[model samples]
Target: MSVCKHIRNQGYSQREFLVLRRWAIYPHPSVPHYTNKLFTHHELQHSDYLSQLCIGYRHILFWARWVVTVIWRCIFCAYHKLFGRKYTPLPPIEDLALVQSATTLAEWIRRGKRSAESVVRAYIHRIQTVNATLNALVDERFAAALEEAREVDHRLASLTKQEREALADSHPLLGVPFTCKDNIKLTDMNHTGGIVSRRGIKAEQDAVVVARLRMAGAVPLGVSNVPELAMWCETSCTMYGRTNNPYDVTRTPGGSSGGEAALLSSCGTALSIGTDVGGSIRIPSFCCGTFGHKPTSGWVSLEGAGLFPDALNDSFGIQVVGPMCRCARDLTLALQVMAPHAAKDLASKVQHTDLRDLKFWWCEGLDTPLCSPLDPALRHALTAATHYLSTTFEAPLEKLEWPRDMSIATLMWNNKLRDDYRGQPPMTVDMTNRKGRVSLLAEGLRWLCGRGRFTFPLLMMATFQKLLAVNEDPQDSPHYWKPMQEFLMGTLGKTGVLLLPTLPQLAFLHHEFVPNMLDFGHTCIFNTTEMPVTAVPLGLSKDRLPLGLQVVVSPGQDHISLAVAQALEDKFGGWVSPVPVTV
Candidate 1:
């Protein structure tokens, strides 16, 4: 490849401009940079000059797209400014804090470099100012939070420096503020689950996830809002008004985790928690332009989730309690703090882990019974991610086949056996056994037996009450359960990890239904797989809404998932604050 040919191939014209000797040689002190720097007069030939012209033409064509991309982004931002959603009294820039790879907000607070009182006060003030409009937070725990901050500060003052450092590493969340989906129970707070029936009810004990977060030193700002029964995608309930996107108030923040997403995106809080039976966490994160994670079922203890009081006994399949944040580091940080695991056990596991050595499989599109086209922006983001991921590992990228029959199993586990079943259609249509009848009775019976019960009528009544009490569909259990097992045993037959788009579109209109709500098959399928899935923010949508990706790893391999999420963040832009500086 002579310099002249390279230039011609790059699309430079012959005779129009000579390739001077100074241009072709290296280290020319100064001879007009750009094209001239790569070629010299002696190296140029008539044959090569033609090729250089072609090369130059191609370069122009390639960079032209980038120019268009920037122009498009500018136009989108301007439109959002003019007629899209808007927020009042934008938050101060100082409130923004970047979460470290494996430390939760609480951990950030506990680090003591930042005042717990300052963090708590900032969030409390933000909530007071903006929440009324967004309606993202249903309950405010400001007084209690102040008291907790006082205690945290007192404790930190008493500790020696080394002890403080060790404690910060162990419990980084000590003073950080956070919020959780209303569906999860936190002692002393109402566990609405977005249902009017449960309005007055408060948890008798912290849900396991809540307890873990508290243990890590996080102060609760209050319970964030969610959709009714968390069954819908937009964040609106009889108890709380709809949550709107911070980028554009008219558009939806994304649900069932919309509240958390909205609050975090607006800088009302640094990090938060969201539950995903389907796309609750990822949807809101993507819409709000943040990050969220849906861990494998049972990876995070569901013992205290307000939904289906008996999470252990019910077959609630796809439902998972996970972290949602504006930054990928915050997602991993929240996961480590909330998921049920002994500190000693996790400590031992973290001793011998390396992210670079891991294997990751990227699946942008799936061929399945629930196939649908992804939005152009989302598609491009996922494809770009796949390209970037290849360099992380020294292995080939393989496209995995989606099992057509898998959705049937997923529907069953996600919808069929929910504790809240009140004659509603299950999330999946697989209520029929192989015999082809809606033989859900047998499955329900098995559910009772799985909980160690055999009586049909009494068990049915108990299930019904559980459903009513927690406001979860009793049918979703079977809908998510069977399919999850099948998905794990089948397509994911391999041992490593997989990646996929978090949602098909950008943040949707506030209170609008996804054009095709059922397409969340991508997210729900993983919920069925019951594997720990890490949601990492890749970038913004073509329209400036957030876009994210989920990394699904084998069950109980949470450490690996966290590692992979951290690695992805290292390579891509994880979370960017919605607040922008005018200067």
Candidate 2:
């Protein structure tokens, strides 16, 4: 049989077949040029074989690491308990103008209590003061935002209180200034998205969410930075520099949407737009001490956004554009603006539950199979949260088992991507300014020689992850994690929520993500399982870094999760401002 037919019979897609063909014609870093043809033509299945082997070995490593992480966690946590108590105090929030929530600010602007331009200016000043240190605001429209805010104030002047209230319904966020992750388009702004090649590119249009916010009277201040292609967990890229945590300049802000988290926590913007696939929104929010919400899949529009695999067209529902802010209320407001069509229905469905009837399941710092045990501070935060709810609100908090074994969750998420890709044209993975494929091996050599357009993580993903085939995700089904989703929904029903770890530990130091990669997997599970998760901050840890947990609810029951987040915020004081020591 022909090599093409052999690979086809083995169920490789035309895309995969072309990849193998490319290997035969092009030079490989590891394979000799003379032997390339013989290798691809005769042993095409070897690529798939290598992929499966690596994937299996990764799972084996997961369990092996699981054993060591648990034992080490106990000893390390004890050591920290005795000695790790120093904290660098956060500078006081210098401006009272930055303290109000988006909802409060908008109301004040409408009532002529506070000028909208003043609010915009306050935030812009904050951005300017911090961006030098944080590098969070990559693109700016500060002048344009001020003008828009002026227009809003002018329009509101002629309206009565009732009329202003009516206006608030349609333009709920009117007069509030906001920023979005670079992946979300802001018209006439550089959407570099942290990739080197796209340095001077401009967004010709506003992302759907951005437009909705504008329509609602929220002025756009700028776009924030993201990791290249919004792929990796950290936000630094070749184009824009790294974004530092406001809580501690020494630690990272968490990636993909790390800039958004850093900016929000620093009071650069009370609310901002962000996207998440593999815990991008949740992790950064956890790191920078902010509130973030990943809405139920298909709950928000993805039009004009750069989310991979097209969440709008795909059913996997893992990738989503969401809200990252300093307050839980902003999450609901942002979601409403993003999906205005569903606002009424969602509001009606999201009813207040009696504390007694709400089924609250929690995990108090148990170690997951592949992730390190939760840090003592984070574990204590969870215990405090559950204890507060149980005693104060009489919430029925129960200890529950999370994914001690993530082998199934990872496979389910992988299958989800496969199904999403098959539905759409496969996502492009190039880093050059031009819109075309480039040689992975060629890029690697350039990188080694100190001249590469792509980041190291992107290269690694392109090489082995693309070449090495993992086990086939079941092609017959669109709902890859259907059983798991159903089980979770059935368990939570309508009146239940789960408070779980946002990450295993507090934010790590900058460039220290590689070792804790497994812990980030904790966020990915919810994306695949298809639930609404709200990152609720539980004040700062003893180390003065952010401490938080996720409030997850059944599919379509986002209001329940949002409510739980509010309750927790009320008790714990959500998203403490992480000002610099000199602020």
Candidate 3:
């Protein structure tokens, strides 16, 4: 048998075999290069002594390479820890226009207190000045937005005072500049979801929500960035790149709506539309210290949101399109514009439950291993939020125990999502090879060598999906989900709200989220249960990073969550502008 035959028999590919041969024959100059010609020659392929020597050399090289790689990673991490840029103290905000909520901005524009063009220009100038450091806006329609703003001015000017009042009542968001998550289609903008391959793919028409917002007289400024396929909890991709938290440029803004959250945090846009299935909207809101809402499933249409094929079925009645904004009032305004049919009935019927009449349940943390212990700051924030609500509303707060089977329930929901892509191309990893199936070990090695193109979190999700795909039913298990859903709904029925931690910690440093992915369970659980949740900012931490809590209510009770969020916002200064960090 020849050396090539030996490698083939050992299950190594021709390419891999050749590479190994080269490495063994030409070992690093600093290391001993095995100079035995017999080891390289086919003539000695069958010789037991030479074969054993070659095997031993290969093993030694493998271990040596791994050790060196580990050492390099350690050094890289250490260097970043020492020299990486962090967020600096923010300057006092002098521009009241920048901090004004969408509702207030619209009111000003409608009342002739501010011109539409001026408001739009102020945001454009701010975005231009800070976007270089934040990288929040992936696409800008500034020129078009300005033109639209001018048109809005002309329209308002043409109307009499009585007509303007009527228009304001009808078009509440009129002339307000807002943004859309890149995944939420805005006609002619890239709907890339931060995937390099999807760049330049423009939406032919606005998404349902986008269309409605446009009709409501709001000008679309542009689209924001997201993680690839909108998969991770941190915003980054090879296309538009990573978005930094305006509060701390070194920390993540969270994802897949991270860019929108960062933009809102920086006051680049007063209100933005984002989608959430597994906490995409709320997590970013928490990280950026902005308000976000995930409406009851099916409240907002998913049309024109660039989801993966067949995702609608898997995530049916689970994912939703909602709003992220600087103020909770804007959430109700945006939701009304986006989901008018549902909002009309829900908004009118949504009587504000007095704090005295409302029941409050708080869970400091989850019972599952998937969740990390809450950061001390986050715990304090939650506690403070609870106390404020309790004292102000005179609402009694009780500790609620998380379901012991919550982890498995989450997994079962995810398993159903995975089945949607069953015969499609694998998302991040290529499991199929010319030889046969590729091992995850080999793929991981390829990733370490910089040969893999996928991001680490994406690869991890792909691996998870592949593992869960086995023996997983395409249909969701009602046995697991039904009872869980019923229990959650029953607990929060009518006038009850659940206060839960939005995330285990504040926005992590970029690339630091790979290990902390499991902590996402904090938000994802509500998604699984199809509950409406409002992510309410609890002001900045002592370190100036954002802290927050999730206000969860039963399905169709979006107004309940939003109301709670507003009360919290009023008590705790909401959405403080991050002190701009120099890149």
For candidate 3, write residues 1-583 as lDDT tens digits.
3344544575554444554453333221222221222134443434555444444555565456446445544664686679976543334454678889899999899899999999999888878877888888988889999999999999999889888888766888999999998988888888776655565878788888899999999999999988878888999876787788887777789999999998888878888899887889998999999999998888788888864534444247567889999888888888888888888745444445456778899987564444445678988888898888898889878887543324454564574354434455565432221124445666678779987545667767778866755554544342234445565776678889999888776777777666556667778777777788999998888988998999999988787887788788889988877863333
- Candidate 3 residues lying further than 4 Å off, grouped into runs, are 1-79, 83-94, 307-310, 313-315, 345-351, 405-410, 416-446, 472-479, 580-583
* Highest lDDT scorer: 3
- Give Cα distance to truth, residue 560, candidate 1, Å: 2.6
**Candidate 3 at residue 404, lDDT?**
33
TM-score for each candidate, following the candidate numbering: 0.70, 0.81, 0.80
Report how far off residue 273 is in candidate 1 (Å). Answer: 2.1
lDDT of 2: 0.74
lDDT of each: 0.61, 0.74, 0.75
**If ranked by TM-score, best first, what sequence of candidates would result?**
2, 3, 1
Count clashing residue pairs in model 3: 1
How do the residues 118-184 of candidate 1 rate in per-residue lDDT, one tens digit apiece? 7788778877777867888887779999999998899988888778878865776778788887777
Per-residue alpha-carbon lDDT of model 2 for 1-583, expressed as tens digits?
4345544675655645565433222222222221212234335454766444344455565467766765555555565556544434444567676877898988888788899888899899988877888889988988888888888878888888899888778787888988998888889988776777677888989888788888877889989989888877888888887778888766779988999988888888978789888889999999998889898888777876783324355354878888888888878877888887755545444445456668888864324345665678888888888888788877677775432234345556666666555544322344654467678888889999989777787676556446634455544442255555555666678878888888887886665565556676678878777788998999998778889999988877788887778888888999776653233
Weakest ten-residue segment in model 1 by summed lDDT: 426-435
Lowest summed lDDT window (length 10), candidate 2: 27-36
Model 1's alpha-carbon lDDT is 0.61
